[model samples]
Target: MKIAVASGKGGAGKTSIAASLVLAKRGVLAMDLDVEEPNLGILLGCSPGELRPVHQPVAYVEPDLCSGCGRCAQACAYGAIAWFGSGLPVVNESLCHGCGVCPLVCPTGAMREREKVIGEIRSGFVDGAPFLEGRLEVGGVSTVRLIEATIQAGESLHADDWIMDAPPGASCPVSAVLREADAAILVVEPTPFGLSDVAGVLEVVADMKKPAGIVANKTGMGDLSLDDLCRRFSVEVFARYPFTRSAAKAGARGVCPYRSEETWVWKTESLWRAIERRFS
Candidate 1:
């Protein structure tokens, strides 16, 4: 059973809950799909893993073999290529999405793809569970593709119980990670702002028609009436974590509260079992 834990906004304890569940059990594969900022490994007390660059095709022009037919420029949907009715087309690397269409439309075979490392996928272990995380290049905007590639690598291992730590919000990257999820856990704080964030993610999950549950993290901090909201949507709020000083302190130091204390550890164990009972 593949489960994804996500939120509509960042800092909603999404990663904390995801890390807890993955560590609560032995050999449960944990994948961090937040390519822009993956901290699951750090929270799980592990070093950087085996790294493989996520390569993308970048268009390069072969001036000698160029016919300046402008076919390559016309085929580029991203407008990465520009031709002025003479000479080889100029390629804008920053605008390129690496679709490889320019090369396919090149009649003289003048356009070809050069592999560029835009990001990397790392594989390591957190306890006995396999850990995979994707990191995008600084200033790189190609998160969806990197998330897709990272998940594909994880799927190749054929793990039965996988927990995906997805990016926040209902954007393309989050959708990419949740596409293959068997179940989704939308973690949110008990606040009006938190509900707004949850609403955004709920829309996407609902449209996908995936079985989903809610988690009210940092409970007692606010009275957001999450129960009524869940009831209206006919979704269950399965877990709630009370705000605690220890959790705050541990999080400040890049540590998970469940890993640092036994009480939180047990709480996480029970929470995962509840999730399995309902979704598995």
Candidate 2:
């Protein structure tokens, strides 16, 4: 069973909850699909391993074989190719979506597709448990592709239980990971801003028809309640963590909040079991 720990916005305690769930049991495969800003490994105290490059196809022009037909530029829907109508067309690597349309429209075969390194996957271990994380390269635009690659790599591990730390928001990157999960745990603060953020994600979860529960983090810090939103989505609240000075201090010091306090550990374990009983 795969459980995806996600949030609609950043700084909502998603990674902390994800780490707690992974620590709930031994040998549970933990994957960080937040390629742009992956911090699950740091929280898990994971030891770094081999770095595997993740590739994506991007359009490139060969000046030697050039025919300035401008057809390649015209055919590119994303305007990745720029033609002066006299010389070789300049292919912008960043704008290229790798749709393979540019190469097809090239009459002189000057346009070609080349693999570009968009991100790297790091495989490691957290207390002997397998951990995989995807880190997107700077100026990378293929976040969805990287996320998909990360999920594929994790699937190869063949672990019975898995916890995926997904990126924030209901965007394509988050959907890419959540689409493969068996269930999801949405961590949210009990505040007005937090409510709005989670509402967007809830719509996505509802649209995907995925079973999801809520974990209200920093409950005492906010006066607003998530009960109405939960009722609207028919998502039950599985756990709650009150705001505490120690918890905040521990997180700032790169410590797992659940492990820092005894009560928090019990709360996390109970939440895990409840999730297992419902989804497994």
Candidate 3:
């Protein structure tokens, strides 16, 4: 089962929880879908292996075979093909969604698909467990596409357990990861800021119709009641973990605290059992 660990805001310990889940379940496929800032691999204590470029078909015209029929321009509803009075259309590569419609309507077969590198996927291992991550190229626009590719690459490994570290916030990238997940583990701090942010994330998770439970982080601190929010959303309280100086320092050094912290390991195991109950 692929479980997504996400939050509406940053610094809510989502990635830590995901990493902990990986420790609890050995030989799992751990994926970091946060293409822009992929740090879970760091926390996993593994560097990504050789990078594999992910390509998508972008429409380009072959000038030699061009008829300038204008059908290619007409087929593009995204205005990716900019038409000049009587000359061949210029393709705005950034604006192209790679729909390949231009090729379908080209009369002279001038339109062709060229593979453009949108991002890179890396397959690696953390403590003998499969670890996968995706990193979008600089100035890339296909965020969700890359995220989908990362998830698909992880699935290709065919692991029985999967832990997905999702990017924070309720953006398309987050949706892309959470929508396909078997369940979601939402981590929220008890601060006012975290509470406000988590409210929006809960709506997104609910809309997806995915079973979710809240992991209350920094349980002893903050005034905002995460329990109230969980009750409001009718979500189960998966785990409530207290703050510890060791956990914070270990995380700062790119170490997986769950590996050494017995309390953390137990909490994560309990969290896993609670979440798995929902699946059954």
Clashes of each: 0, 0, 0
> By TM-score, who's the top model here?
2
Worst 10 residues of 2 by lDDT: 41-50
* Tens digits of lDDT, candidate 3, 33-147: 9888888988888898878899887888899999777888877988889887567888988777798788888888889989899989998898898899999888777778899
Looking at model 2, how many pairs of residues clash? 0
The per-model lDDT (C-alpha) reads 0.88, 0.89, 0.86
The residue ranges of model 1 lying beyond 4 angstroms of the native Cα positions read: 64-75, 82-89, 105-108, 261-263
Tens digits of per-residue lDDT, candidate 2, 1-280, equal 9999999899999999999988878899999999999899888888668899999999988888877889998999988888886888898998888889988988888889989999899999987989999999998888899889888998899999999999999888888888999899999999888999999988989999999999999988995977799899999999998888898898888888877888689989889878987787
Worst 10 residues of 3 by lDDT: 218-227
- TM-score of model 2 (CA atoms): 0.94
Once fitted onto the true fold, the runs of candidate 2 whose alpha carbons sit more than 4 angstroms away are 84-87
Candidate 2: residue 224 lDDT (0-100): 90
TM-score of predicted model 1?
0.89
Clashing pairs in 3: none
Of 2 and 3, the candidate ahead on TM-score is 2
